[model samples]
Target: MNSLVLIAVGLLGILSGWFFYSRFIAARIYQLDAQFRTPAHEFRDGVDFVPTNRYVLWGHHFTSVAGAAPIVGPAIAVIWGWGPAFLWVVLGTIFFAGVHDMGALWASVRNRGQSIGGLSEKLLGSRARWMFMLIMFLVLLMVNAAFATVITNLLIQFPTAVIPVWGAIVVAIGIGQLLYRAQVGLLWPTIIGVGLLYGLILLGNAVPVALPAEIFGLSDRVVWVLLLFLYAGIASTLPVWMLLQPRDYINGIQLFVALGIIYAAALLSAPTVVVPFINDQVPAGTPPIAPLLFVTIACGAISGFHGLVSSGTSSKQLDRETDARLVGYGGAVGEGMLALAAIVCATAGFATLADWQAVYTNFGAGSVGAFVTGGANIVSQGLGIPAGLAATILTVTAALFAGTTMDTGVRLQRYVIQETGAITGIAALKNGTLATLLAIGFCLAIAFGAASDGTGGMVIWPLFGTSNQLLASLTLLMVTVILARLGRPVVFTLVPLVLVLTMAIYALLLQIGTFLGDQNWTLAIMALFILGAAIMVGISAVTALRQTGFSLLAHRHPAE
Candidate 1:
């Protein structure tokens, strides 16, 4: 098929969804009101709670939630075929992800910008809320470990990305200080920051940074992982505006530019899809597309993780409650666009079928590797950039995505730990520094604890998808309950909730069977735990719904 046709269809679908579907959701389902005060204004503290421009907040939310999942997930799932992947990415983003994200943000904003874990207590009972926090703690540990490992491996794979990656951090810190401390306008400073980032990319391409093969008897990758954790530990504890907001804004701009180049290349080069529309060559014993495909393409399509970013960070920064649709739902559209770009690249960027198959032969690192290379190929072929330079550009872009997400994951995990501790009456765990250290330690242990092959994230990646979807299901379920309580039509959130919950449970069961058959007791046990937590939360939500039959419950306003 012509690449333009595929690109046009995907882009059109997403745009139309944003214009019509999302607007309907905002007006009818969410019923956002600008008259209400926002938590950012009510709790204006310069630290975590500060009102932010909608555009700037959108940048932070999008980048934090985008991470490498959208790129990696769709890249991997296309192995099933382009058609199924494309359908899920488009439809799922519209109905599932956008609604879930917008709903989560709405819930948080209405309740004093509380995190999802905090909102659960208000919407459901205390038992479900605590269970939600426990699940959040576990899921975020996996998130931090996986993203840290992924970034480390990317830097090692593309040494040129290291200097640019670290350089951007320094630039971000400088920009943050100037903006927050000096109270300078962001226009000129942002331009300079972005210019410096691109300039460093050029220099990094020339003089790449790479650690030696061994350090203190540890492999280079291991050493890099440790260094990454150290950086994350510090970054997560810092004030939000100082690093997280400015850094993610810069990264988001780079991603947009990258997307522009890749899409232009797809149009100019117009490489045809060598892989079939529907691939029947999936590995033996792999689960069918019904549930497995849904989980595999979680981030780009619909992710529970987006809710965490929405409630945990973005909610506190939003200037108005009505902006949730634009930031939360619109950000999901941006992600869907990225996913579509990946689909176009994966399906048509390669020159031949053999070349495509070689990269996509398996699911682990190769899925990520294929996207970097395929994207590079598109840019190089279309923009006439040298192959090496093109690869360096995309590689650096991927690293930035991973780095931003890893630290943010740790930061959110720290919040969950502190929240859990306070709820459970564990004083020590509520200490900020201690919570951060514990979060980082657990991430390091998991990342380093995998098989000797050191593909810990890859080993746990399948479970991560299932867990991620389960989280989304629970978040949507809460939204459904909230809507029911408010006496609004619950069909919008309820339908997606049912579909996602069924898919997640089905996928978990299949994973458990496979892990047991392969004698991988660890994954099997984790799967069981995820299933149990999910069931517990599900039961709680259903019971709450039954007891309160769509009656309006007294709600806490943002001013409270």
Candidate 2:
């Protein structure tokens, strides 16, 4: 396929979803009202549910939703061929993600910004509330662990990355304090932060840190992972206004800027799309089309994890129901654009298929980071910057991006564990600090296990996708139940509900089988989790069907 045509198709997919399906859902089914008082009004808490302008909410929503998952998933998916990867991204965003996000926001709005867990209980049953929380905790733990490894690996491989990475963190904290505590507006702080961060990058090249070949006789990977968690722990403990929100705003802008540069380069060069639409080179027994592609590219298309962000953080800040369309629907499209950029970078900039394959073989799992850094290098070359410096800057930026994701993942995991403990009446686990520590411990254990296995834990990628998708499926089911209760049209909710559940279950089964055969402790733990998820989904589906049937019957009979 021609590169330009492929790129156009990807953009068209995003636009179609944004304009057609998302708009329709926002206006017709959700019937979002600008006049209605949102949860931000009803709850009115300064922390979570403060009323904010749609623009500010957009910043929050974008940051919360955009993370390592979108980048990592697309990078891996492109290995199969950009065609299937791009197709899933486009179609999945339109039908699956748009629906999932809009539904979550709508449900949250109706329920006064109560989380998905609470909404599930109100709509599905008390059991679903517990199941949702449990699944969310496990998923967050895996997300934190996986991205923790990814970030640490990148940092270890490129020691110079620490300069800009730490600089960004420091600048973010300063900006956060200025904006929130010092009563300074966002304008000055952001401008100053960006400038300072760039300056730090230049200085970093002058005086780079040179560590011993090993730290404490441990591999560089191990040291990096420990430092990353330590950083996450501190970041998570800070007030949202002071660190989390400001860092997210900076990261969000950087993401867009990087994307613009990459896209401009692609269009100018108009590189050939060398990757095949369907590669016969794919190893046998790998289902090239349906199940594997669907699971592998989960985040770009329709991440269930987005549901957590939508309901957990973004929903609480929405100023009105109408804002849901912008935050929920628009956020998904933004992520789709990120995925598209990854595809373009992987395909368009490569000189040939041979070069692409060489990078994949040489860098191994690090090919995605290398590809992106190379893209940055190409842009730098085209713009007359030193390629080495440019690549180092880009690599550091990617590391920072991954770091932010890990921070949020850790916090989400803590919330999940604490909430689960509360619901389960586990007094020992109810302390927030204790729960947070346990959450971190769980993630560290997974990372250590994966590292020791020497497989680099690429096998865990599919499991992450499955867990994320299942979360989305469960969220959709909850949305359907809520709509049914609220007497809204169930057709929209029902269709996507079935689709996500089917995809999630198929993916889970594949994971369970793979894990069972592996028989390792990590895989075994994953298998047990998958089995529990399977049962929860089955039970939830049956209950939802029965509830829908009763609603239909009652409507027809005008119940006595």
Candidate 3:
């Protein structure tokens, strides 16, 4: 089948979800109130709690939750065949991710902007909250430290991307000043910002910037790591309007433009999908497609991490309660679109099935590498751009994604720290500056302390997939409990909650065995411990759901 077939179907289904189903959920279920006061206004500190334009908030939430996962996940999941991955990315985003993300935003907005973890404490008990928060802290640590290395390596490999990638920071700051300080409309700033960013991309293509072998005796990679962390620390602490909002907003626009390039390329080129619809030929020890596909493609289809971004940052910036449908659910749809594009690039870029098989020797063989390689080829062929320049554009786009995710992760980690301090009664931890210091300090330690070369952040990378999905499941559980409390329909949240928890736990168990076989005690023990914590939280959820004001707790009745 042609790659355009997949793009056409995916777009149709995704748009239908946004237009028809999301409207239904908004009116009949979520009942979003346009006049309702949002926490962005209620707690407008301007630092973390500034009320934002819905378009800008959607951009922030979309890019923050995006990372490299949506691209990586679908690209890798093409091993099973593009069909299954395509279905999951499309259907899962609409039913599972869209609802979960929107519900988390709504629940948080309704509860005075408490985090999903904080909501867990009130509904599922303190123990559950502790478990929930621990998982999130580890996930954030994985993101911040690992992404610093990811961005550094990308800069080193694609020197042409460096200029545009760093140049975007200056452009975003100017946009922020125009939008907030000058009080101008978003239109001019968006157009000018995107134009300048792409111009940087063109200039970068002309004058590639390469770092020296060493900067003051430290390796170039180490210097980049330090610089990245330093920037994240300061930028994350700035007011939302100053940096985070505009930076992510522009990056989001750039990414959509990139996606549009790929989609148009697929439409024009009409490249044949080289991979099989279903790979009946077994690749030796490939894991069963059942639960593994779900975990493998978490972010593109559904993610627990989205819940963190939603409740942690997005809910705080929501200008109106009604905007949750657009920001929360719409952000997820944006991710789904990215994933669909990934599936197309991975499957159709190669000349034949044999070419794809050479790369897909195992379950995790193809990720960002496949996405970039395949995407550059398609872009070059369809747009008449040189291969090297096309590659640079895609590379810079991917690096920007990782950078924005790190920004959000650093800030979210700080939130986790402050929340932990309040719960533990540590006055110092509750202070914003202190907590941010602790957050950055811990990430730096993980990067430098654990390894001589500042690559220790990768040690915990293996656990990110399972732990993240489990956390998503728990967030759904939190939402389910909240819906129960409100005496509203529970089916929307409840079913996805059950499905994600099952798949994530099953995948976690599988990883434990793999870790044990590989003699990776560090991963094995950590996975086992996380599994135990998840079970406890699940039990807590069950109890919370059962004890709900009698009948509601028993799910409307014992015999229902």
Best by lDDT: 3
Candidate 3 residues 1-560, lDDT tens each? 98888888899999899998898888867889999999999999988888999999999999999988898889988899888999999999899999989999999999999999998898888988899898889888988888888788789888999999999999999999999999999999999999999999999989999889888899888988998998999888899889899999999999999999998877778889999888887488889898889988988889988999999999999999999999999998999999998899899988788988898888788787788889888988888778788888888888999999999999999999999999999889998888889999999998998776778787777788889899999988888777776666778888888888899999999999999999999889989989988899989998887766433223343223
Comparing candidate 1 with candidate 2, which one achieves the higher TM-score?
Answer: 1
TM per prediction: 0.95, 0.89, 0.96
Error of 1 at 428 (Å): 2.4
When 1 and 2 are scored with lDDT, the better candidate is 1
Candidate 2 lDDT by residue in tens digits, 1-560: 55667768888878888888887888766778899988888987565566765655665566666666677677766777777888888887788787888788778787877778767676667776777777787777777777777676666666666787778888887887787679887678867877887787777766676456587777666676777888887776555566667787777767776677666666665667777876556544545455667666766688777888777767777878898998888878878887777776676556678776665552124345745665664566455556667666666656766777776777667666766777779987777678778877887777776666222334465567777777887787777666565556667767766777787777667666666787756766865776585567558756775665534222232112
Per residue, candidate 1 scores C-alpha lDDT tens digits across 276-356 of 899888655445888888888887789999889899989989998888988999889989998998888787878887878
Clashing pairs in 2: none
Deviating ranges (above 4 Å) for candidate 3: 549-560
CA RMSD (A), model 2: 3.4
Task: By lDDT, rank the candidates, best first.
Answer: 3, 1, 2
How many residue pairs collide in each prediction? 0, 0, 3
